[model samples]
Target: MHNDCIFAIQLYFMQPVTGFSKLSKSQKIDWLVTNHLNDNATARETLTQYWNEDQKLQDLHDGFSENTVTNYYFPFGLAPNFKIDGQLVTIPMAIEESSVVAAASKAAKFWMDRGGFKTVIKGTKKVGQVHLMYHGLSSEMDAFYAFAKAELLQSLEQINASMKKRGGGIVSLDLIDKTKNLKGYYQLHATFETKDAMGANFINTTLEQLATTFRLKASQFDGFSSDVPEVIMSILSNYVPECVVNVSVSCKIDEIGTINGVTGKEFARKFVQAVDIATVEPYRAVTHNKGIMNGIDAVVIATGNDFRAVEAGVHAYAARDGQYRSLTKARVENDTFIFEADFPLALGTVGGLTSLHPLSKLALQILENPSAEHLMKVTAVAGLAQNFAALHSLVTTGIQAGHMKMHLVNMLEQIGATDVEKDLLRKEYADKTPSFSALRESLLVLRS
Candidate 1:
């Protein structure tokens, strides 16, 4: 009995506390500092200090995810002077990166004088799959699927009524045969058009309903006498290559004029070469695409869409053609220097956090409540514009000149420089490249 009690005590010491999430917000923080954090004083304030000033807003933030602690904040800023589809629009961006918003705004202003961005909605088709396991003959499986296809569509009529009424619904359904590769694997691949909603819930709910109906109907089919097809899982696919948008910006090479001493013709040549490197090299492509997504994801988050989903779908599209490649392409044609890109985005203007989060509601209002396609265009433009700015720097003044200059502000804040100290340091680094060590030394000397 003594040995068992000792064993229980050992397990108690080893295991994490159960009911952490069950604790109240204050109690949770108390337990966190007492059990997990070594620096009680610093951890307590650091964790709780960013709490929303409004109690109602804080409560709303706490409900966004599990373990109600404190809200981690991101800077919400705007990039103005974007003329997309002949309308001037200011994009809202939520990010911690110091230069992303500024870079986007610079690019927007540069192109705003040219022709702005022109975007075309290529398609808006999202994909989902109902994976199945059937140990029956391929021919038998095919026949069963043929019968089940129409039935599956009929079964989801109620679920798709509203989506269809909105001019969006199931586009196509096909039976993908994969028996040879996985012994007994097949899929009921489906396509959908969700219109102005991201439609994750709609697609998933419909797929699950279809999966249930498909499983139940197996008994009615003679093709599966004893080899009943098992529904493995039904879920949406983020690899949405068909849901694509194309955005481009162009100007006469001569009208591009001079930038930072480089002639327009020379800049265009070097710019196209930089894009070519990213197109052929995976290492460059990843970073190149990441720059584009910096802008895409910032606006995506600001508008309360799922940036993770947007990211997944986008990266998948980048690697769709066997190797990873750049999303943006550039060239000189007819004395016109053109930079363009294709983005596969599945974003919604409503539902989820759009209506729930106060900031998300404001973001949509700022866009004047765009439709899903319009949002896709603007989001693509943000990415394209961001890529343009990054490449522009890469070809001309070097990325760090502007990037490190912007990062100097962060360095000042990090070293706890006063307003006066920051003002002095800012002027000093206006035309100089500032380093972290240099900033710390400068602050120390200023104080001395």
Candidate 2:
């Protein structure tokens, strides 16, 4: 017999299976191990290693999306003692990066007695666009827009009724002419107040409906009777400049006291200078903003909000004035040190994964079930506090000292150090620079 036929005969005798997707969960695992893996017992053991002890909980997790797979976990940490807008709030952060949570907590505690963090929600308007192409004259496009605008808004009444009851829906729509920039290209700009929801689905639904209404209405209007506007696409924009939050921390220069061996006044001047450099230098601003997002994204993920969208919007806002600059600003006036950051943040507390994920639900509960507005304030404060902590380190004892100290534990774990070895290495690297390769070599020498 051919080799394939012989192999198939052996496989069939070992384990015969068909209709894989229709198999039960246990059966599927059996088939997976028997047919696909060389070491069936080890594969079975490894697959089950990460499953939750509670079958129901594991089933619920498996039901989160198609295809059953094990859960992936990140460290969920809490940064306590955050005083935001006079409320003592403990922020939950989920991240795998070392020292981010520690840095945020340290900054929050440092400013806790120095007036804490203050925040304000400047606006809460999210946007969407219906891109169009009109080869006709500009006046015809203008006329078509003027005539179609009311009908477009009226068409969304049924769709927006439920949202409107909750004090959120289509707020405004405008016809923006982009012929100057691109030939025969224009946009129907729509803005919304989604309230407690991120409203991606809502905005897209509304825009699609508007685009449909515009195309239908334009065909009948005399202005576009010959040339109907072509709808290219309808989607929501992640860049929400109108949705913004401002967070700040201020203290008397004398209250700054000492940090990392630098005196209060000297620290204040250096802090201002560092911020000034970021404002002018894109190279520094990129890292500066990254540090701020480390704190922001941690809180955002913990609450089940979209961190990618927030990151995109905040970075776009940073470069709004033609040059990318520092998100955090520091200034010294009359012996008083002030630091603040203002950036666009569109977040939700009611919809999306917040209600679905158990950890997210618990995180929201731990945050005292804040409203969307309140969450925005808290998230902004987290970013501000993180930036402050990073700057404090950058200007004083330098970024590496504290960063490496926190990283030492990770290094030890990476080199397979035992409890005794970890303890010994911790003391050895107490005042020395910690490096992964060096620690690994030291452990090898000690073992020898």
Candidate 3:
């Protein structure tokens, strides 16, 4: 009896509570505050402060995920005057980075009269895999594939019916041999065209069904009646090399004109040299790609697409030649300064949070309700423009000059400056470099 009581006590401490996942949203929050937080009342107040005031809207947000935590917000801003393929597009970007929107807007304006950005959608193919293990002979494995290929395609007819109506579904299936890498290992590789959806769930569901059908059919096939292939797992691949978009901005070297005290010819030459360094140096390429993602991810989040997937595919594409290199390329030919980026981006326009989240819906509307292809083009242009702007600053007045100027506002806020004090400091730092420590010391001197 004593031992039983001790065991129960140990279990209670090891596991916080029973049926935590099944708890009501309010009950979960109550439990969290009561047990986890240092100050329960203050925690409760802070959490509730972030909630939407409208009851219906709060409920909608609560349904987005488990635990019903308070919303975390980012600044949603617009970079106007982006002309892509001769059409003007004002991009919506949701990000916490201070200078991304400003940089993108500046790039757009710089190129608006210099022939803007151009984009092309190369392909739109997503992928999934069904892993399997077969200890049988190679001949048997080949025979099994021959038999299973037809059955797998026939089995998914019902599943593919609706997708087919929308001009998408399974595009092709292949049996991949991996016996050299891992003993008794194989994969059923499948490619899909999901149209306007990101299609992770769809691809996963289809792969699972295919695995099931393969196992059932193998039990009845002559070669596998006794030893059937072991079903390992099924999943969707985020590294979508087939789904690619290319964006480029080009202008005559003389048309680059002058900006930030750098002549057009000097700027173009330095820009191409910078890109060449990134192409050869891994250390520089990572930062170069990160700058591009700053623009890509912002638009991806605002439009409710999966930014992580886009990031994975883009980075993989960058390293496709076995060396990690810059996604953006720049060159000069016949007095034309050309900057271009070709990367895989499997984004969606009509599914997931696009239909659910209020801001996502508004973001799509702001883009004028683009199709999946159009969204791909817009996202690519944003990335290319951001890289161009960053390089432009780097080759001219240096990055920190303008960046720190914008960052001065954040530093002032951090130092508890009032509107009048901030106005005074802005004038004081107008011609000087701004730093947090310097700003704080200046504010103290002024107050004293």
Candidate 4:
């Protein structure tokens, strides 16, 4: 009978709960705890602990996503002393990684006296596409697309009315044929100037409308009476290579200053060598580029832009030359140290989470409420600063010393060390590397 009862309870929990989404927050938490958490009251308390004391604010956060339970938090840090384009700005970064904010901060101050980062906006035209298929003569399709170009663009005027008033709208809309690659595939490649908006929704909406107009017009066109092109999909492409920003930082080689007892010229030579290795070797390039993104992504997230989309677009841009290489370049010419980077950053200063999240609003405020172009320049500078810090550490006292030193406090907390014990161990391991096991043993010695 006891075994039978155990089977009944297991079977009961195995059955899926109906209308789970419709359940109240309290009911959902209760159900979760009862069914999966082994009735642990602490699990329920953990969820409630992260809730805001202000009910209205808590509700706003909950509505950001579906089936929301609790707010997952990240440390919001500021890296000050960033001078970009003759203006000083403190960048807001949201991340949990150790030593990232510190590295960026150090790099910013390191360059402040030498020369601040210089940034230029290369282009801001974003791209989208409408894909279609039609088993028809290539010549006929080409002529028909040419005829429809004006109408396709005109159809966007109403949709882009507000954007037009803001000096942003359609840049170009043209048909691209890909019949050789796919038997009947074609695309209506479109570009737009989104100005201060990231413009994913704007681009996608424009493409879908264009697709609708094209299919309707194709049904009536003389060349397509027999076979109208079939609309497959309309979406915005994250691979906006044309939308780019250029970031560069340079100063006299001799003025780079001594580092870890190495002369400025020697450090410059080693730094250029390290960047060169990453440029040619794929294995090292991946990590090198990742370090750059660590800075870019942190700012992107803190400002509430789509970091995932930025990541996808950035990695694609890196491999655009048919090979993955470091996104940054370094060279010493005429006794001057030069470093530069160019990459796409489709960021926005408005809309999405920027208008919704409180912290995101603060990030923009900290940035002095920059326009999209300025935001791009600021973010690219962050990436450059982060890379410089990493490479400087690599060619200096090494990465582990500072990185592990930053991790010491966390290690002490994990082992439940007292405040006094942590301070003592911190000094002892300040110049030395430590592992968890070694820390544990030493911790025991302190107690003994």
Question: Which residue pairs collide, candidate 1?
Answer: none
99-198, model 2: which lDDT tens digit per residue? 8999999998998899989988889999999999988888898887878778899999999999999999999899999999999999999999999998
Cα RMSD, each candidate: 4.0, 4.5, 4.5, 2.4
Tell me which residue pairs clash in candidate 2: none
Write model 4 residue lDDT over 6-100, tens digit each, in one string.
65687576878999999888888888877777677899999989989999999999889987878999999999999887788899999889899
Separately for all candidates shown, the number of backbone clashes (residues 3 or more apart, or on different chains) is: 0, 0, 0, 0
Q: What's model 4's overall lDDT? A: 0.91
Sliding window of 10 residues with minimal summed lDDT for model 2? 31-40
Residues 259-338 of candidate 1 have per-residue lDDT tens digits of 99999999999999999999999999999999999999999999999999999999989998899999999999999999
Q: Which structure is stronger by lDDT: 2 or 4?
A: 4
How much is 258 displaced in model 4, in angstroms? Answer: 1.5
Which 10 consecutive residues of model 1 have the lowest summed lDDT? 3-12
Model 4 TM-score on a 0 to 1 scale: 0.95
Candidate 1, residue 398: CA error in Å?
A: 0.7
Better of 1 and 3 by TM-score: 1
lDDT (C-alpha, whole model) for all candidates:
0.92, 0.89, 0.90, 0.91
Off by over 4 Å in 3: 1-15, 24-26, 224-226
